[model samples]
Target chain A: MTGPRIALAVLWKDIRLDLRTRDRLGHMAVFSALVVVLLSIALPTPTAETRPWLPVLLWVVLLFASLLGLTRSLQTETEEGALAVLTLAPCDRGWVFLGKGAANLIALLGIEVWTAGLFSVFLGLAWGPALPEAIWAGLLGGVGLAALGTMLTTMATSARFREFLLPVLLFPLALPVLVIASRATAEALDGRSVPGLWWGALALYDWVFVVIPYLTFDYLLED
Target chain B: MSAVETQEVEKRYGPVRALRDVSFSVPEGTVTLVAGPNGAGKSTLLRILACLTRPTSGLIRILGRDPFRKDGPALRSELGWLGPEPGLYADLTVEENLAFVARLHGSDSGRVESVLEELGLAAMRHRRARTLSQGYRRRTGLARALLHQPRILLLDEPWNGLDEEASERLTKVLQRHRARGGTVLVAAHAVPAARELADQVLRLEQGVLRMLPGGPREETHG
Candidate 1:
């Protein structure tokens, strides 16, 4: 009925749909844990010297895991011709984009909440005065990710190697989210003072970068 | 009320022109079947009207509101569309899928169950969309298009994959809607159900749209 109400409806449908069979959160959790294990073994951080690196590494792994989920939506969108149905609706295509972005942002945040908690415990990483700061970092990262991921996923539906294309294309667009998340995370985890500039920097990228994807999403969804 | 109007509508993909100087108007509350061979721009015209595709050039309005002014959602609040092979989320049960769209349009989920029951889809409420046959899935799309009680309905190839019963059901629904002063536009592969229901027929070919000579007449296409 209302704009946000419509968005929530889409989000609920996606969540309920995912819950019945695939378990998006569970899949992301497992994938994230696997990445965490791999990172732990690959880097040889026996003395906890790589502790500051924990925040960044885990976030990177989680980012990949979220991408894994985002990439998977392509098959469903194509098979269902959901894009066609969505485009054909009397509502604005931007609402469709925004609805999807909000859904993805929430889902990614769900994964981050769980993965961050477990990752901290396993990595023996401590969050000091920057504990709350690290979370804001995570939220910004998730917001930026949802904006770009939905835009690209719309394109990947038209592509042949969508899964491969998502990460390959995303690797560049996502560098900003990565740099900000990791730097703020590194500062927070190491018990260093979180810089005022980094927060502003992440927020700037969030607003500025999102506008491009938001304004252009409808074109990508079209034939 | 005029249901739709387009002036100098042209859509192009780079150098190729898909729609050329398409100007047309349809009287309100009529079943205007857009018929043509493949690549006749029928689908393109429907997309522009549905506000899904923007014309590379021209002015168009749905119920008199400019559809391409970047204020589309405002216009979309009252529009309904059924695309060819409208895909539902495979993992969702039929009921869940229905309720989801209903609520998305700010309607009640209970109405979804009732609508499904009315459409004889009650028993399969828990069934996944991927599990339904082609005909039933199209029914799901039809149900969603009918949600929100839209004043305008745009269906692209509405009769594909339907059996006699489903076809009859859809015809009845359209007849009821038309009787209520609602406007219906159908892009059908063949003439559907009763010939008496159409107020006008349109033939699309070679990037042009024109009215068929006979009003609401039966057309037998081989």
Candidate 2:
């Protein structure tokens, strides 16, 4: 199979596996919802001053939930030794990274949508005109998260305490995506115009990470 | 021509060396059984030949091509590998697992059906791999590896979980593969059936490799 075709097969296989077991993606969505409820209970009512924190809090929850999705995404492959087959397949190893990233992107997007709907109802904030902007920021940020997370996941899979190590390694590297995404999302939620800088930074973060995984993933799988 | 060749290959993890000065060659259309005790580096050698790991400091080639280069995956496409782990997706049904592997090799579903039948897994085709017994799971892994009809097979401990019947079945399938001029390298502590099919047997111990006078049959049968 060609590179993209192999990637598509990987994506399809992951989707089917998710549909069957509902393991990683399901945990992410449910975890995000739980965080939303718990945080809402802990905080005071959403006043004009407190409402800004809502977007930051939402992104925070999504970010942590995304970590779960990323870590578990490769767990299945490792469990069955399937990564060996994937790496040895007659396509560039970068395609495996792309396939893994795309699958995580789809799973994270599901969580993103779920969190967005629930946060709106719980915080009583109207997306109004900012819904589109917020969505764009979320999507751009999701791409960055998935791309970097997949690379880090592959790196940590060979480690002893990968579950603990992935977040430690991922947070610093993923700082750009988080910072830009939070700022853009907060602006949209506040009904203020988001600066072009944050969007550009998010896109740039996505671009850098996407290219990096393509280049370094071969070594990561080299073992 | 040699189907696999490694010259003084070495694999070191920190201060410990897993493979040291390991050198061997398997002729095409033959089976070589790798015999060794625990920590003997049999798995490491097989992993290198399967293109799953690169040798630290030696020349290694599969089908006469450097497997650590850009076209490694292309070269590996013609080989099948079954590691110690079953490597079958637990969430996927037996048929799905075979089909998925076939797709990865750009083969058709017909191959998947044939392998399932060949491995006597057709009845359990719809069962999830996680729910299968150890023997069945091994069968599933074998089916996946053989689905593409690869020219070479790299198997690490193929006889681990098989019952007598399943083991016999696997030996027959492998004999048929060898009859078709496919090369096979199997790493195991004791594989009597494979020994019967093997033209060469190698022993690895403490990161070193040495040739045995006879096939593994001499070691196990008598």
Candidate 3:
């Protein structure tokens, strides 16, 4: 099969599996909701002084939730050794990585939207003024997180302590994404323009991650 | 020409050596049985040939091309491997699993239907894989392996969850594959039907390979 075709097949298959089982996506959604609820009850009312912290809190929630979903992204393949099918693809294994990463991006985007909605409803944070910039931040941030998380997740898939290994490997690498995304989001929430540098950094991070995984997936997928 | 060939293939896992200097070749249109005790590296050897695992040090050629090189992915398309696990998505139905594989191989849905019918899986095509019994799961796996009409088949303990009738059916399938000039390498403790149909027997003991006598080619190497 061609590279794009293989990727699409894998993408569709993963989407179908996720829909059928509702394991990874469902867990991430519920986890984010509970965290949001706890924060709403614990933190003081959303005042302008505290509102600046919302962007940070939102990014943190996104990071953890994305981590949650990323950790389980490959579970279906590992559960029954179905990853061999991917390793045996008729094209470069990178295509398989693309498909998996795209699926993860989709899942993360969904959670980002859901978390945003929860924040607005539970915390009374109005997003109307900065909706467009916030969305841009979310899109770029989602891509960065998805790219980095997917690669780390695959690297840790065969490890003995993968559940623990992913975060250890992910948190440090993901620090840049969190910082840039949160700052851009903070600016957007403040009704200010997001600097081009932040966008550039996020884009660069996403590009590096996506390219590295594509080049190395052939080895990563191997035994 | 040989369909599968390996020379001094060695696989090591940390301090443990799974396969040591294992070497043998199977001619085209023949069935070769690899017999060994558990942990004898039979599965490891098949995994290497399947391109799922790389040998720590060795040379392997499938259809006269090095599968670890740039041609690897293309070469893998012609190989059908079935390990202990069915390698299926349990949430998907049997047909969905097969269809996914077919798509991976750039095959059409017609091939999926064909394999389903051939394996007597059409009746349960819509049944979720998780709901199937062990035998049916294995059947579905076999159907997946055959869906792409590969030129070479590497099967590990394919007879394990099969009943008498299923075993007989598998024997027939292998016979037919060989009849069509396809190569088959099966690793198992013992399958009477496979033994009767085997063109050559390779014995692996402690990661060493020996070609048992009575085959057209005989070789013993450590």
Candidate 4:
């Protein structure tokens, strides 16, 4: 099969599985909702001083929520040694990586939208004014997270402590994405234009992760 | 020419050697039975041959091409592997699983129906894999492996969960494959039917490989 065809096959398969089982996405959604509910109850009323911190808080929630989904993304593939079937793809195994990463990207994007809505409903946050820039930040941040998370998850899938290993490996590498994304989000919330530097940084981070995984998946998918 | 060949193929998992200088060759249009006790490296050898894992220090060629090189992915397309696990998606129905594999191999979607019928899985095509019995799961897995009509089949304990009828059906499938000039390498503890159909018999003990005499084809190897 051609590269894109392989990727599409994997993408559709994962999506279909996710829809059928609702295991990964369902867990992530519930976790995010519970965390948001706790934050709404525990935090002091949203004041002008604390309002700026919301962007950081939002990104942090996303990171953790993404961790929930990313950790389980390969469960289906690993369940019955199905990963062996994926390794048999006729194209570069990198195409398989792309397919998996794309599926994760879609899932993360869905969670981002859900979390944003939850924040608006419970935290009394207004997103109307910041919609465009916030979307750009969310898109770039989601891409970086999905690419890095998918690659690291695959690498750690066979590890004994994979559940613990993913976060340890992910948090450090994902710091830049969180920093730049939160800053952009903060500016957008304040109705200020996000500087091009943050956008470039997010884009660069995404590119590096996507390219590295694409180049190294052949080895990552092997024993 | 040999369809599968390995030279000094050794596999090590931290201090423990799973395969030790195991070398063997399987000719085209033949069925080779590899028998061994549990933890006898039967699965490891099959995984190596299937290109699922690399040999620590050896050479492996599938259809005359190094399966660990740049050609490995393309070469893997011609191979159908059924490992200890069925390698299926539990939530997907039997038909969905087979269709997915067919697409991965770029095979005609029509092959999915044909394989289901051939494997007697058509009746349960709409059933989720997780809901099927073990025997049916194995049949579905075999169907997935054969979906693309691969030139080589690497099956590990394929008859484990098969009923007598399913076993007979599998025997026929192997016969048909051999008749079509395909190569088959099956790893198991002991399957009388497999022995009856085998062109060669190789025994693996403690990571060592030896050819059993009296087979139609035999080769001396370490």
Best by lDDT: 4
As for DockQ, the candidate ahead, 1 or 3, is: 3
Which candidate, 2 or 3, has the higher lDDT? Answer: 3
- lDDT (tens digit, per residue) of candidate 3 on A61-123: 999999889877768778777888888999999999999999999999999999999999998
- List of chain A TM-scores, every candidate: 0.90, 0.97, 0.97, 0.98
Tell me the tens digit of each residue's lDDT in model 1 across A21-62: 666666787898877767656766546565666776767887
TM-score of structure candidate 1: 0.88
What's the lDDT for candidate 1? 0.75
Relative to the real complex, the DockQ score for model 2 comes to 0.75
Which structure among the candidates has the greatest DockQ? 3
Ten contiguous residues with the weakest lDDT in model 2 chain A = A118-127
Candidate 1 at B70: error in angstroms?
A: 6.5
Write candidate 4's Cα lDDT for B155-211 as tens digits.
999999999999999999999999999999998776789888888888888998865
Screening candidate 3 with a backbone cut-off below 3 angstroms (N, C-alpha, C), the clashing residue pairs are: none
- Provide DockQ values for all models, in the order shown: 0.51, 0.75, 0.85, 0.83
Query: Model 4 over residues A1-223: C-alpha lDDT tens digits?
Result: 4999999999999899889888989998998899889999999999988998888988999999999898777787888788888988888989999999999999999999999998888888899989999999999999999999999999997899988899999999999999999999989998899999889999999999999999999889888
Against the hidden true structure, what lDDT does model 3 obtain?
0.89
lDDT (Cα, 0-100) at B189 in candidate 1: 58
lDDT: the better of candidates 1 and 2: 2
**What lDDT tens digits, residue by residue, belong to model 2 across residues A67-171?**
988877878989888888787778888998888899999999999989988898777767889988999988999999999999989988788999999999988
